[model samples]
Target: MTEVGILGTGAYVPDRVVSNDEVGAAAAVDDAWVVRKTAIRERRWAAPEQATSDLAAAAGRAALESAGITADQLSVIVVATSTPDRPQPPTAAYVQHLLGASGAAAFDVNAVCSGEVFALASVEGILARSGGHALVIGADLYSRILNPADRRTVVLFGDGAGAMVLGSGRGARVRHISAHTFGELSGLIEVPAGGSRMPCDPAALEAGRQYFTMDGRAVRAFVEDQLPGLVKQFLHEAGVVPDDVRHFVPHQANGVMLDTVFEQLALSRAAMHLSLTRYGNTGAASIPITLDEAARAGAFRRGDLILLAGFGGGMSAGFALVEW
Candidate 1:
């Protein structure tokens, strides 16, 4: 079997920096409260003209440059996003057009924040069989869907995109990938009115059902109950122990919740990579964005084990182990 690996990684957050004070003012919470809860001081927001595809394309270009590959070399372009540019066409189609990757198959995957890892898992098989490079991107424009006054959500999301180029070459060699979804808990996080279940009619708009919402308490409980055990099981299945892992790149969901899960996982030798302090939870973009930041910072050593984990709406969790 051909070995698939990350050829390059890249990320793009919007130029506009939104401070805690700005979001807090709308959510009726002070900076201190926001910081105490999420450890996020600021996050980026897309300009009115920018959409998810714009960010994804910018990041994709960067990743292709980093890989020393041209867009024409790509055989697949997969965008993992919850907030698509529109309902009809896939966001990846827009990204492919923007990048001039006309030869590649384009599509979108919506595993919510877990979409990146799920997309990675999907592309790995395609590229392994097809024998060409693939661009996997995770992007979101949460600022557009957020209810400004909903502190539980609006304060926790930002706009950004991250990408990775995969091929049979140097870089992080993917070792194992796995994903799970608990559909019974789907209501824990959701945007209630945009889909067929509840059309965005006048009444839905008036009810504020179009805005993103979450039961923060239940989500926290779900993560606390499931993530650690899942991580342990995944490592065991991957034939590695916690002590052997050197870096832990997880969804930049909540700093405090992550701290708790980090402790429970007992990966004592691994350093947790976090970008949420500056970017907040960037939906599906979190893991890849954080991974790109850490990689560019020279955080990994040759032959190091890096674990990537993402968990979010769809009540899903995805994990990937990479040998760096």
Candidate 2:
């Protein structure tokens, strides 16, 4: 069977930085309270002119440059984002245009925070069939959907993008990839309106349905209950023990949540990669952004065993084991 894996990676964050104090004031909370709750000191917010595709394109260019490939060489483009520029067209279409990847098959995927991993799984066939490469980018403009007054959801999100160029039979071999979704818990995090069920209007706007909402308690409970088990299952499938893994790149959910999950999995501090403090949770872009930072820092040794785990809204969870 043909092998498909990452060739190069890239990430981009908006220039506008929002400090905890600023966000706290908007949310009617103290700076200390905000920090204690989300473990985020600050986060990036997109400028009015910048949209999700702009971030994705910036990251895509970096990834392509890293891989020593041009946009036209890519056979497929898969973008995962919850906050699209508009509802009518898939965000990938704009990203494809921006990247000048006119020949690539482009589309979008939304599995909430698990989207990047989902996009990876979705594009395996393209890599295999083309016997070449594809670009998988995870970018989300969460700030666009946030309700400024709702600190619970607002403080936890940032806007950013991460991209990876994957080639057929290449670097960082993917040993296993898996995902599961708990639809019953889908309501835990959502943009309540603008969809077919509840079209956007003055009434929906009045109800604040246009902004994203999250059931913090339910989401916390769900992650505490399900994520660790999924991680264990993933390791089992990869036929590797937790301690043997050199890195555990998990979703940037939060400091407390990630620490708890790490403890439950019996993983050590040295084995974890975290970027929450600097970026908070960039939704689908979190894992790849974290991975890119680590790679750029020369954090991994050749032949190292790397594990990627992500879980979030859609109550979705995904894992990928890579031999670096």
Candidate 3:
């Protein structure tokens, strides 16, 4: 059997930097509070003209370059994002056009913060059958949907994209990937309007339903109830002990919830690769962005075991165990 794995990874954050103080004032909290609660000090925001596809294209291009492959070689393009270029014409189409990967199958996946992990899992499955390279990207432009005045969601999100090119070869094989979704809890975090249930219009805007709203308290409780135990189970099923893991890469959600997960798993802050403090939460793009940063810094060694887990808005969570 041909082993499927990432050939190269790349990430992009807009040049525009947003400090904690900027977002903190809107959320009615000081910079210290933002840092204390979420450990996010700064994040990048896309320029007014930049959209989700622009960031995705840039990251995808870099990934292709790193993989030493051209866009035409790509057999598939799986873009994971909650914020697409538009409600119609999936964001992957735009990215595919930008990359000139005309021959590849293109589509978008929306698992919110867990988008990349789920997309990667899908890419692996696709490659298993197709036997070719695939570009998996997680990109989002949260600033557009977030209520500028709503401190809860605005302060925690930013604009960015991350991508990885997967192919058949000798590389870090993703040993195990498991995912589960709780549809009943989907309402825990969401954009209340714009979907079929509540179409976007003047009434929705006036009611403030158009912006992204999150019950921070509820989300924290939900993650606390789900994530740590899921990680432990995934590790157990993969037949790997916690100590054997070289790195635990999880969604850069927040500090408070992360603290709980760390305690439950008995791991130190250093063991869990985190970029939340600097990049805030880039939604679905968080995991891959952090992975690209770590991989670029020469973080992994041969035969090392790495764990990747992500959880968020479909009220979903998943983990992928990799052998480097």
Candidate 4:
């Protein structure tokens, strides 16, 4: 069997930097309150003309360059995003066109913030059988769906995209990947009016049901009650112990919640990778963006164990183990 691994990684954030003060003012809070709550001072917002595909393409170009491959060499392109440019035509299709990856099979996966890991797991199987390179991208434009006056969701997200080029041979070899969804808790995080069930009609728009909404306390509790055990069980199933992991790249949901869960996991030797402080939560892009930053900074060594964990809307979670 050919070994599939991440050949290269890349990420891109918009140029417009939004400060806590700016976001807080709209949310009826202040900089201190925002910082004390999210540990985030600022985040990036996409330009008026920029869409999710634009950011994904930029990141994809960088990953291709880093991997020493051209866009035409890609056999698959999977974009994980909850915010598609439109309701029809998958976001990955636009990304594929932008990158000129004419031959690749392109699609989108929406597991909300856990989309990236889900896309990775999906692509791994495709590449394993097809024997070709693939590009997996996580991108979101949360700023568009956020309720500006709602502190709960508005101040916790930014616009960005992260990408990884996967192929058979050398790189960070993927060990195992797992995903779970708690459908009963799906309403914990949602945009209540956009889909078929609710349709974004005039009434829905007037009702403010189009905005992204989340039950913060419930989400925090879910993470606290479930993440650590999931991580432990995932590791055990993969035949690895917590001590064997050297790096943990998790969804940049909330700094405080992450701190609480980190201690519970007891990965004493592992260094938790974070980009939320500077990027807020980039939705599905969070984990890959953090991973790309760490990789560029020369953070991993050969034989090092890296864990990628993602959890969010759908009340879902995804985990992956990689050997560097």
TM-score of each: 0.99, 0.97, 0.97, 0.99
Report the C-alpha lDDT of model 1 over 1-324, residue by residue, as the tens digit: 678999999999999999999998988998899999999989999999999999999999989998999999999999999999999699999999999999999999999999999999999988778778999999999999999988988889999999999999677899999999999999998999989999999999999999998999999999999999999999999999999999999999999999999999999999999999999999999998999999899999999999999999989999999999
Model 2: lowest-lDDT 10 consecutive positions = 124-133
Runs with alpha carbons beyond 4 Å of true place in candidate 2? none
The residue-by-residue lDDT of candidate 4 on 171-290, one tens digit each, is 999999999999999999999998889999999999999999999999999999999899989999999999999999999998878888899999999999999999999999999899
lDDT string, candidate 2, 194-228, tens digits = 99999999999998889998899888899888877
Clashes of each: 0, 0, 0, 0
Give the Cα lDDT of each candidate: 0.95, 0.88, 0.88, 0.94
Give the residue spans of candidate 3 off by over 4 A. Answer: 267-270
Winner on lDDT between 1 and 3 is 1
Error of 4 at 95 (Å): 0.5
Candidate 3: what lDDT? 0.88
